[model samples]
Target: MSPGPGADSAPAPKPHDDDHTSGTAPGDGPAGRGTFSSLGIRNYRLFFTGAIVSNTGTWMARITQDWLVLTLTGSAAAVGITTALQFLPMLLFGLYGGVIADRCPKRLLLLFSQGALGLCGLTLAVLTLSGEVRVWHVYLVAFLLGMVTVVDNPTRQSFVSEMVGPEQLRNAVSLNSANFQSARLVGPAVAGVLITAVGSGWAFLLNGLSFLAPIIGLLLMRPAELHRTEPVPRGKGQLKEGLKYVAGRPELIWPIVLVGFVGTFAFNFPIWLTAFADKVFHAGAGTYGLLNTLIAAGSLAGALLAARRGSSRLRMLLGAAALLGVLEIAAALAPSFWLFAALLVAIGMVGLTVNVTANSSVQMATDPAMRGRVMSLYMMVFVGGTPLGAPVVGWLTDHYGVRVGMATGGAVAVIAAVVIGLILLRAGGMRLKLDLRRGHRHVRMVPRERLTAVV
Candidate 1:
């Protein structure tokens, strides 16, 4: 999931400890409570804690789901199909989800969607526990979960601003990434143990139970403390308006487009990891879990850095994307399992940097009124691409080889970075330059007019 970016409002300074209430006073601007500034806001703290619990379960369920499908069917393609079905709703209905997000109260929407997702988890748990679970059953449950996520993702994303406000928006977003990554670190290890000890069914059940924390947190929040924005009015063509809004901003649209490529192709980590573990490395569930844990460790580090950095920038987002692309290629060519695992850490860091920066930048560039729609679009382009890309990558891994699939994704990501970078330079009216000064070479991207005059 992505975070919203820069703001039209200047970020108010960190709030004083002496002036603090249960949270900030109304209209006082967003307060960075401390380094963990967003936590200073009571509402945000509740949301944060609940989110971490839920994210752990979410990650556990993801690993279990893929592993279960592979165990049941003994086919990587089956896992791919499950993955595609899980994200297909985001591709098909993500825009409508965004439209609904704009029109509804996000907290209320989250409560309903979270419950629906829990029910899906419970159902899958029951079916699997019965030993009657089928590939079709997994497929159906995955599709249903995806349907809920279509609404849940954008609502949850847009809700962060209301909890922490614009002042801590970037910090809150980075912390959210950190929170999710932390869950990723813990979830898989636990799931691996559970699967080895008892079964995947228990992992699903735990996930179902995990949703309760967030629901309770949402209920306990003081609604009045929320930094609320007006919901978009019900009207036709609002979707088109959101589309036009993104289309008008080169900075926003280009990163989004780049993410679409990366998300579709490069971000299929679960598939890649699973293939490497089961096939390439001839490893078991334990090794698979370790690989995920390493990536999450790197992701946590990246998220923390992003939080301390305090702002999202366009240049950094692009640079991260390019670096991530290069890292993926290196990992693809890695000869040993340990080397590949090590590369995953760098992959996780660069990948999370790209995600956090792009998410923050998009949110910052958007109008509060239009945030839900824009974020939905951002999610749509980034996550929705998975439905299209996963199965193809899976097929390539199954038939050609895992390295081939990995290389394909990396190559596509690198191409996307170069193309998007060129587009940004052209839009900014600048050109790349290489010069040698005092025997030390420097490459500078300079204005087209300056280059012409110098010539």
Candidate 2:
């Protein structure tokens, strides 16, 4: 993978072609390599430090926003609407956002997007503080934020490779998730206290101020050290070309399809958790925050474990997703609050595993030239499906019990994992095998030819 046309500006080393090997110097042994190895790079360290602060504020805003919407309308369905508005742009213009990401400098795009996101938060903060806020005002700000995220999400994802290069990409991606989940552990707890004491306005104000850290970090980065890719020139048919490229690769395509299914139906936690906290348990905002914090604890553990691994596997993605579904079902049926809370931790761990595995696998399989567009489609299917799924989940929670709504989501995840797993196996010219003998491999996917020869 040599640098394409127009990449001459940056004189950094080219990214390695291999995905599994770390491309380290001979003297750099195991001691120099591990989960935190990518943080050794100065630029990534700055980015990581700034990102943790911004991510914490983002999480606080999320908790505060959901609670505010719930308090205003007193309907679970309204919270779904707010979530939907915030993600609607991704569903509609996600591909175009990818095209823009490929054409523009990712760092610049992130700066502009982050600033716009901060403005949205500040606007909401002002309205709420002045006692002029209405439900529609929140909806409008959410939609504006989504418009910015249409460009921000893919840009931020593709930027990781530029900072860490190929060998350390998987580790960096896993660490990024760990950073978010770590913030998640604190954000909701803080939001709960603020909402109870000062009010949601203060949370929004803090979130608006948080974007400055990332902006300053970006300015401090060294341009010559970045592994820059040539920006895709403006041209016709590029979007279609990106789509066809993904369509041809089973390794890239199948994992994405599986995530799309799971993300769409099973990942409606905003709706389910809020409903359970309010309706089922008769608890207040503190309980909702506690549920989120528990999930975050498990997610942080899952992300740390992922960072320690050397590679991502499709099998791991499938297994984790299946486990996520089973855990969700169990949590949905728990008879007591303590039991349900305990299950949430396990569910969070498996859910994060599924996310990290799929994300790294897809990025590893993609070409640098096509990464922006590929990641855009990846994010589109993953987060974009929220608009369609959230309202339905909210309605179900409103009409049927929260238990039924959550269990249904779990059922969808289980069915999707089984179906996609079988498809991937068959596509690879393999078949599932079962053996019952002691000390034997009981279940696995064997090559079709190997099974035929055994028969």
Candidate 3:
């Protein structure tokens, strides 16, 4: 569930005076509102709108990029390599990016990072359009994109608190996921059509141009309305400070650890889906795109449901993760394409529940002054683990067959969820309780002391 009020050592940062203009003052506006309440804030509304366009483009690029790698090499491992290259920088330098985000103006940092990201996309587009693109060229651009993401991801993540304040942070985070998943529903379908009709290059070109929407949105934001935090002054050992902070808090540490396991071992969908499309189903890029769209549909639904919820619970997080693993395993063994595809939708829903719950819970538990570094470490473990997982999953798919690879990932997720859940229970002096009586709650976690007293 929720962490205690004083979970972090640092005092919570006060909202800027201009935050009142954004309509997020205590007991007013979005404060005690419903699912779409965060959108009532003008600044967040702009950020959300721009994100819709940019995120759609991002999904398009991702689909096109993976397909291009598959087309160029015809090797699943190569696709894994592309994925790995894209996230490797986060593994190496993610904490440092958090430090930068904490020390700088987030809006300014976002401007530069977003511009650099657009440039990276444009460069890739030029290469593809000019017929000069090679696998190495794609790899180069992916790495550069990742370098920017090391800073961009943390800045963007922590910026939500400023836009909406703590009152609406979870709502905004859920809506952000919803926005991305909604784009997922559209981007792949469009990419499929483009790849089939025009070419992957045009998809790449469109993705490059899509960044302009977000850039323009950033410029239009009212800086005075933001709930700004005092930036952490530059200093040595700040990374270590962040690390130590997380280490001491079970609420922050366990969620990050669980997500790390799931992210690294279970979230290799690109590799798994591509292999299933080409090898198992004997299908083409369109099938790949369709499968992605199905997942997005489920994820969007999950995100919307999460937005309506009042709080994030660790029990829900663990249950969703375990369900995701089970669904993945079932999908791996499905005898028909339709059955497998159906399982993917369920997988997407549970997977997103796992993500949104962990993200919101962690953010709610963290101190604002430390959010950048905390979120950076969060993103690093979550996304950075990809480099380690993708190649291994790819190799497994290549040698052991797609079913084995998929099932193995699911098994790892299930194991991680169980292990981490148990660890948390033990640390909290609680135990799982099963009640097999009518008109009673069937299963729950109860404090050991309570159980002893009852006995």
Each model's lDDT = 0.84, 0.85, 0.85
TM-score of each: 0.92, 0.93, 0.93
User: For model 3, where is the 10-residue window of minimal lDDT?
Assistant: 18-27
Task: Return the clash pairs for model 3, or none.
Answer: none
| lDDT of candidate 1 over 1-455, digit per residue (tens) | 11122233342232222211111212233345345777888999989999899999999999999999999887777888898999999999898898888788888888899899889989999998999999899999999999999999889888888887777888888899999999999999999999999999999999999999899999889877887766666999998998998787665688789899999999888788888999989988988999999999999999988887655666677788888988998999999988998999999999999998888777766777787888999999999999999999989989988898888999898898888887777777677776665664466677677673222
Worst 10 residues of 2 by lDDT: 19-28
How does candidate 2 score on lDDT?
0.85
Candidate 3: where are CA atoms >4 Å away? 1-33, 452-455
Q: Candidate 3, overall lDDT?
A: 0.85
Per-residue accuracy of model 3 over 113-221 as CA lDDT, tens digit each: 8888888888888898898889999999999999999999999998898888777888899999999999999999999999998888888888888888887888888
lDDT of 2 by residue, 1-455 (tens): 11233353332232233321122211122331488989998888888998998899999999999999999999999999999999999999998898988888888888888888889889999999999999999999999999999999999898887887777888888999999999999999999999999999999999999989888888788766777878888999999999998898777787788898899889999889899999999999999999999999999999999888776777788888888999999999999999999999999999999999889878877777888899999999999998998898889889998998899889888999888888877776678778767887877667777773322
Sequence-dependent TM-score of model 2: 0.93
Count of backbone collisions in candidate 3: 0
